[model samples]
Target: MSADQWIAFAAAIVGGALRVGTPFLFVSLGECLTEKSGRINLGLEGVLVLSAMAAFGGAYWSGSAWVGVLAGALAGALLAALHGVLCSLPRVNDVATGIALMLLGTGLAFYLGKPLIQPQAPQLPSIALADWSSNAAVRAALQVNVLVPIGLMLALALWWGFARTRAGLLVRLAGDSADATRALGYSVAGIRIAATTAGGAIAGLGGASLTLFYPGSWNEGISSGQGLIAVALVIFARWSPLRCMGAALLFGGAGAVGPALQSIGIAWGYHLFNTVPYVLTLLILVLTCRPGKVAVGSPGELSSTRS
Candidate 1:
């Protein structure tokens, strides 16, 4: 390839990382938070879809992208709150409830979002970091979205909070031992519910990023298994917010490979390249999810012995 092609390919990957990684960043963080609280939300896929629909609809109706983002967050929180509430009941399995919620969220989004298929919604604002660049490709590559910094700040804040805050310690305690938490007079249910709901709200931002920013439209297939993939990302990150951020970027870059290759006129294996993220997910799981070995930093409640 020529120098210009190489530059374009590199720029495409950079741009794709920024654009595609945002959703992964948010979802992974959400999952990390939920897992830290000892509850797994498999329904984040649903949260992503429902919230995406809600965000798009909210932005479309209110004519404000910010409103759409909030709508998405609220939708995710509400759905996740339902999961938390149900799981609090005796004999209700968190995993089963989460799966059911995923279906429910998806159905609700599809039914409600049917009207949203054709309308154009307002898009979020972006920062043109590459405006000073002489190359058009470079300029396009560096047009970072506003949410990227927000995601970064969120990851840093979560890492700090988990390590430094009293509330963080309590959450870790709850995840490690429900009996210990209850013995201390803290309601495990309450902590978990709040954590799950908060995680959902954060994940909802990822949905908003999808509809209000990247594709700038609502569609049933918009999520494309990102929510599911984020579960693995959490495991891959071992529940570290900082690691979650890094994993998200890695997955984002993996996702960008296909498009970058296509941009450089290597389209023969475009579809194959798109499978990189999924392949990476499987590999990570195989490497980390070994038998008889708990992943480092996994919450005690989620450990094989407890589970």
Candidate 2:
């Protein structure tokens, strides 16, 4: 490819990373928070879809994109709360309940979102970061979603919360040792429930980003399994919130490979390139999941990491 083409390709990947990574960043952080509280909520896939539907529907009706974002968060919180409640019941498996909720959330979204498919809702605004550049491609590539900075700040805040705050310490304590939390007069279940709900709300914002930002539309396939991929992402990041942001960008860049190639007149392998993120997810799981071995920095009470 020529120099200009190469530049365009690189620009495309950068743009794609920012756009695609936003949702990954949110969902992975949410999962990280839940895991830190000694619970796992795999139903985030459902949360993403349902929240996307809700965000779109809310924006369409209320004519305000911010309202749609709130709607999305509420939907996610409600679904995640149900997961927390069910998992708290005696003998209920967290993994099983999460999978079931995933199905329920997706089914509900599809049913309720039927009318949303054809409508155009208010979309979130963007920040044009490349206004100084005269190149159209560069300008297009640099147009960032407003939520990108918010997601970044959230990552930093979470890291600080986990490392320096009392609430953070309590959540970590609950995950590492429920008995210890109980000894300290804290309700382990309550801490976990709150963490899971908060995580779901964060993931819901990711869903809102999907429909209200890049692609800027409501569709059943908008998530493309990003929510499910967040599990591997968190594991890959070694449960670090800051590391989760980097991992999300990496996955997002991988996801952008297909489109980047296509933009440079390389269409033959576009579809194959699009599978890069999934392939990366498999590789992360394979490398991280070894029999009888828990990943380093994993919470002790997390069932998946428990031996």
Candidate 3:
């Protein structure tokens, strides 16, 4: 490739990374928080869809992007709370409940989002970092939005709190042994509930980002399984918040492959380029999901074990 061609490709990748990684950042963080509390919500995929629908509907009805974002977050938190309640019941499994929530989230999103299939919703504000650049290549490389930095900051906060704070220590303990946490007078269910709720909120924001920001619109078909893949990204990042950011961006870059290639006039045969993210997900899962590996980093009571 010529120098200009290389610059163009690099610029496209940067832009694509920002666009695609937004959802991943939120979902991965949610999953991280949830996992840290000894539960896993596989229904984040549902959360994404439902949040997208809610954000669009909220924006369409209220004419404010912020309202839509808030509505989406509430919806996601409610879903997560439901999962928390179900999983907390005696003999009820977290994984099973998460799967059910997945179904519920998807069904509700489809039912309500059906009406928003074509309506235009208000757009959320984003940074046009590219505007600061003089050269076209530089401009293309700098179109990242505020979410990128916010997500990064959140990751840093999570990492610091996880390693340093007493509250973080308790969360880690709750995951390692609910009985131990209970022995210390901590409410096991409460910890899990809080984690799941927080996770839902984050995931909801991710969903809102898809509709209110990136695509700046919504439909039943928006947010194509980014939530599910984010579950895998958690594993890829080894549960580290900073690593989660890296993984999110990596997945985003992979997701951008199809569009970036098409823009450069190279149509990947049969649209195979779109499969990059999934293919990467599968590869990461197979590589990391060894016997007993899940139990290693995973919380002690969480239901995402290999068995």
Ranking by TM-score: 2, 1, 3
lDDT of 2 by residue, 57-125 (tens): 999999999999999999999999999888888788888999999999999999999999999999999
Q: What are the lDDT scores of the predictions, listed in order?
A: 0.92, 0.93, 0.84
Candidate 1 yields a Cα-based lDDT of 0.92
lDDT of 2: 0.93
TM-score of each: 0.98, 0.98, 0.93
- On lDDT, who's better, 2 or 3? 2
- Each candidate: RMSD to true structure? 1.1, 1.3, 2.1
For model 3 the TM-score comes to 0.93
Best by lDDT: 2
Score candidate 1 by TM-score against the native.
0.98
Q: Write the per-residue lDDT of candidate 1 for residues 96-197, one digit (tens) a residue.
A: 888999999999999999999999999999989877768887787777778999999999999998999989898899899999999999999999999999
Tens digits of per-residue lDDT for model 3, 11-102: 78888888889999989998999999888899899888898889889988999988998999999999998888888888887777788888
Model 3 lDDT, residue 150, Cα: 73
